[model samples]
Target: MPRRTRVLLVLFSIVTVLCAWAGLMGLGRLTNSGFLPDDAPVRDDNRRLSAHYRAGGADLVLLVRADTDVDSAAVAAQGRAVGERVARSPGVVTAVSYWSAHDPALRSRDHRAALITVDLVENEGRATRAAQDLVPGLTGRQGPVTVSATGPAWASVEGMQQSRRDLLAGELIAVPLSTLVLLFVFRSLLAALIPLLTALVSVTGTLACLYALTFVMEVSVYAANVACALGFGLAVDYGLFVVTRFREERAAGAGPDEAVTRSTRTAGRTVAVSAGIVALSLCCLFTVPLGFIRSVAVAGVLVALLSAAATVCLVPALLSAAGALLDRWDVFARLRRARATGSAGAEEGAGWRRIGRAVCRRPVLWALAATAVLLAMLLPFGHAAFAPSDARVLPAAGEAHRTQEQLRRDFAIVPDRTVTIGLPRGTDRAALDTYARAVAALPGAAEVRTADGVYRGSTHHPAPAGTAPVAAAAPAGPVLTATAASGRESAEARRFVREIRGLPAPGGSALVSGEPVRVVDTTAVLSRALPPACLLAAAVTMLVLGSFTRSVLIPLKAVAMAVLSLGACVGGMVLIFQDGHLRGLLGGFTVTGTLDGAVALFVLVVAYALSVDYELFLLSRIREEYLTTGDNTAAVIKGVQRTGRLVTAAALLVVSAMVALAASGVTLLKVIGVGLAIGVVVDATLVRGILVPALMAWAGRWNWWLPGRLRRRAATGDRHALSTDEGAEHAH
Candidate 1:
């Protein structure tokens, strides 16, 4: 390319990136829907039922804490005033207070703090905006009552906001750490920084892609976090591979153009295959219905492919343009020149070669040891608990988190756990009474509220004097809320949900909605979807890798390694976060005793992708060396020796991002960070460094085995590959 054209291309690229950055900034409007699918029955029912009742619990709640008993006349009067003020707010459709309704469920067990449940207008977008505008004012002093506001809308909005803040904080740390590692590995300031150029483009480009996607689909806020973090990490990865290869080729006496050509031919193929496999793995997430999971999948696949393209297209351009000036700083040369002078026999890759030989010497023993270790890591997963995230995952200072904490500590029946059952249309008075009584009679029911009244055990209390009814003309029919205090994700609460779901509908049908019901339904959805997603991910990964490497066994082995890596990582998470291990080391967050299934699946795809990423780095060299020499053991050793440092540099960059996540206050983010970092480190060091080389050595030529018919086709198809590789030696 001419100098003027190169300069023009660079300027155009910079302009494009700046626009993407601005587009990403405008994504401040991004929001995450409460961890429910768009098509969940609860959404439709709640929209209709919200018109008449605080259906599926309050969209907003004002907690009134007074100096004296909440039932005292003075406090009761103030609480009623607070409720009326909230009710008079423009968007509030209804506001029911403990004082107004005299409902036991609305009052705290200690009678110090009581709730005023507020339902907003039905349109979600307008309701959310209304809650955001109204909630801040409703909090703070209200005469004698000190009010704090929270509810489903408040928590969702707060969590989304906090997550974006943390994502910024996380990248602030991750980028520097990754750069430091790259600096050390490359040993030149420009060399270290050049790879990050690809990262800049990859991240901005992905956000631009997502911004466009938001026009057609509701993208989760978490998707941008995934795209930016993982994009930078993977972009650096491809850059490291290609830049290192170019340097090696140049060092071995190739001209600049010749070196770029060979490096792109060899290392570029690995980057393309790596991206394809990772993209294929992410594609499996479409099996899940949740927008949260599928959103991450879309962002992940986009970043992976874009990262690969950015690195391949730009790194070589920069390297060739810089020419001999690329190594000007030459920190490694300055430091090691004396050693090279003292010992002429010293050479690159000696350490990695020695390690490979050691592992290959006892292949079965090493493989078994690694297997046993990974299995031991997985033991805790058998007893692992799963749940959707609640307000507790937000920062401690957040109003929703504080409100939830107070509810858990002071209330006997958390209104948040109240499951609303939407009764079928045309329910007569008799059936409504019968269904309410039956639900109230269930073993774990805390209290049941029908349109007519409240029921506790065998007792019934008529509705407060002026409360609106579920109109007979309403298409949603009737709505009832059953408060259960067994804990939203607890076995007991879920059991209550299941039992009520099994109950015969009073008129004909019912739809359950609330915290516990959401937990149950989400868990069930993931349980059904995850297995198929994993199967598809693994099967498709094998097909992609197999076609890329022309090796049946290597792809299968790659899948096994990735699965093992993911299992061990999640098992480690179950042990630490779920089982409450090392509280001090993790910055003293609460152990929620369960993993977020959605976050787990997100981490699963990421860890699996990284595992295969390292595997491809290793396999590419081995495949190249093996074809050149037709000697399996030699190829295994040489491949490990050649690409070992490149893999380590890439692995450390990815791990740094995860480590930043581990430091977050959000327990689920911490789980992802610690778990994925540990998993990637183990895979890069132990699995890639040991088991892969050992197994390949033991398998010999079978490591590259393909059916005879396919082998012939691959040979015929790879003529250009052979021509490019004609003069390649086993080692630089």
Candidate 2:
């Protein structure tokens, strides 16, 4: 081994050890569901509501079911006791119960259930801790009431815990299954083990990076899940590319050192370009305002870069150490024997050559047919709708999901469906009345409430005696709120918020906020950002491919093919999840009639990146062959034949990892897993296998055409020119 390679190996080993240590120590500190953006109106409204009502926002609710009426003395007393206990728990900010509020909204219509709401400190970690600490004591039979805990605080804590377990479960399944697949593909234990080791290093390093990020800013628990799955898959892919190339060179009679050097020059360049494409594509997520998607972007880019670096640096060193030993311990000796009897050059991939010939025989027909199939799959996306995530993301059997469902069913008149309208402080009574009336007059508006009184349309109802407090000498600012008849996720509720926002406010300025408004605003943010993000991804992809292949048409074709594959994956998600098809096959989940906004965008970006990833792999080989042969048709055939099996194997490993993630109970994770899995399969088989070769064949020599300056350089016996001349002579 070279001294430089040995030194690099030592440095990487020490860094890997440190990363493992950091990952273990910081694992427990990660947060979950940090999706809300700082500048979101809902976030600001939550803060304001918490400040004003003390326990309005960020409250954990205990649903107390009783054998008799919940309003009975015994049940009420039990509820109060539970509330008081929770209030005294660590990190408790305030607590309210049906007994304390005397509000009808707190009790079920049948009076068999009531709520005790407890608020914790504003910090997510502290609130999660408090909820975890209090849940056990408060749940189950307590005196006359049967208590069950559910609320945002408990949900956050439980979700984080669930995510951690899911990550472990997924890794347990994916790592082993991926290993078996790798072993089958490589037919050598040592070769398979090298990729798995590279993945381990990449994943550990990614987790350590995320852990360090958490200390400075909130890092979602989902980051670990994304990191592990993608890190493993990418490491395996890059390793497969480099190892396969090295082996090919070795088989062609190059010495081990020459094989390693040549493979690094070709496959290493491809890995670097592929990594750049993935990292740049993920960087588009930064345009999204939500923290969760941004966290995914961070973790994904980190993993891609790390995986590429390991493949280029560490894998080569390992290969150098292994030398010819990589071919030892062949599990499938019969297949090796069969290969040895075949023709030396052409027969190595005779099957792939047949496929290439078949595709090129009628390139236009195959291209059109594939494009039609992809478009047909995309038809379901027209019916797709998006909703902001809620407790519905959890499994139906989960306490949080059950509680949310129960709340929605029983508490039909709750204020959560209401939109809070902020007004300038100290507004006159007449202006407040006009503002309330205007808000109430909006379409879908049910009622409006203000400090002055409640109003139905233009009519103001007088407050009952002693219900309205006398005006204080120095009164705090007044805020008016309007409740819609429909639930927050309903179309009517969204329309109501939008119509209200369009109405004139009597106050100097007004801000509307609630769940409905949040959905609208978040959707608006993403919609505005999507175009720019897509453009950025395209530009980056074009630059990377152009640099790698030195051809403008290949990059354009790659971008177009990636978009088609992404459409198919997204369309599949909508058909399966949103339309409620394949529920039995994919596990039961509540069809919200809409996908989560973040999940949709997350899947889109990820699917596109994976598409580009496979595209680059196939293109790199084709470009190499094209430069050598100076014959587009021959290059297309040779490249596809050479890379077809490697790409297929790598895709299987990645799809396995993603499918393991689909086994998670969390609907969002499942969506991501299934969506990306489908994307990989489609890109690997239909897109890369068929459309790429077909299109390249259709373009003929035009596939290699370059602009004036580069064309001049190519004709002057450059490296590419020399390769072309040598290839022509070899063919003769």
* lDDT value, residue 452 of candidate 2: 54
> Candidate 2 residues 110-192, lDDT tens each?
88988776667765566777788889777888889888877667777777877888988999989998989988888999998
CA error at residue 227 for candidate 2, angstroms: 0.3
- Write the residue-wise lDDT of candidate 1 on 1-732 in tens digits: 668549855774886668587656746766666367556666676665666444535778778998889989889888888888888988887777887767666778878899888888765555666788888877888777888877777777786677788777888988899888887888776877777888888888888888878778777777777776787778888888888998998888888888887888789888988998889889998888888788888988999998888777777787777777877786677667787888789768888989888888888898888888888888999998899887777777878888878877887667668887777667888888898899999998988877677788999988767654321123557777788857887888889988998889876678677778778888888888889999998898888888888889998899888888888998988888788898789777766778899888878887898898899889888878877788888888899899887788788988876767777766767877787787888898878998888888888888877788998988776665765566454332
Candidate 2, position 289, lDDT: 79
Tell me each candidate's TM-score: 0.93, 0.91
The 0-to-1 C-alpha lDDT of every candidate, in the order given, reads: 0.80, 0.80
Runs in model 1 with CA error above 4 Å? 51-54, 71-78, 88-93, 121-127, 331-334, 337-344, 425-430, 451-478, 718-720, 727-732
Distance from true location, Cα of 305 in model 1, Å:
1.7
Highest TM-score: which candidate? 1
Q: What clash count goes with each model?
A: 0, 0
lDDT of 2 at 350: 79
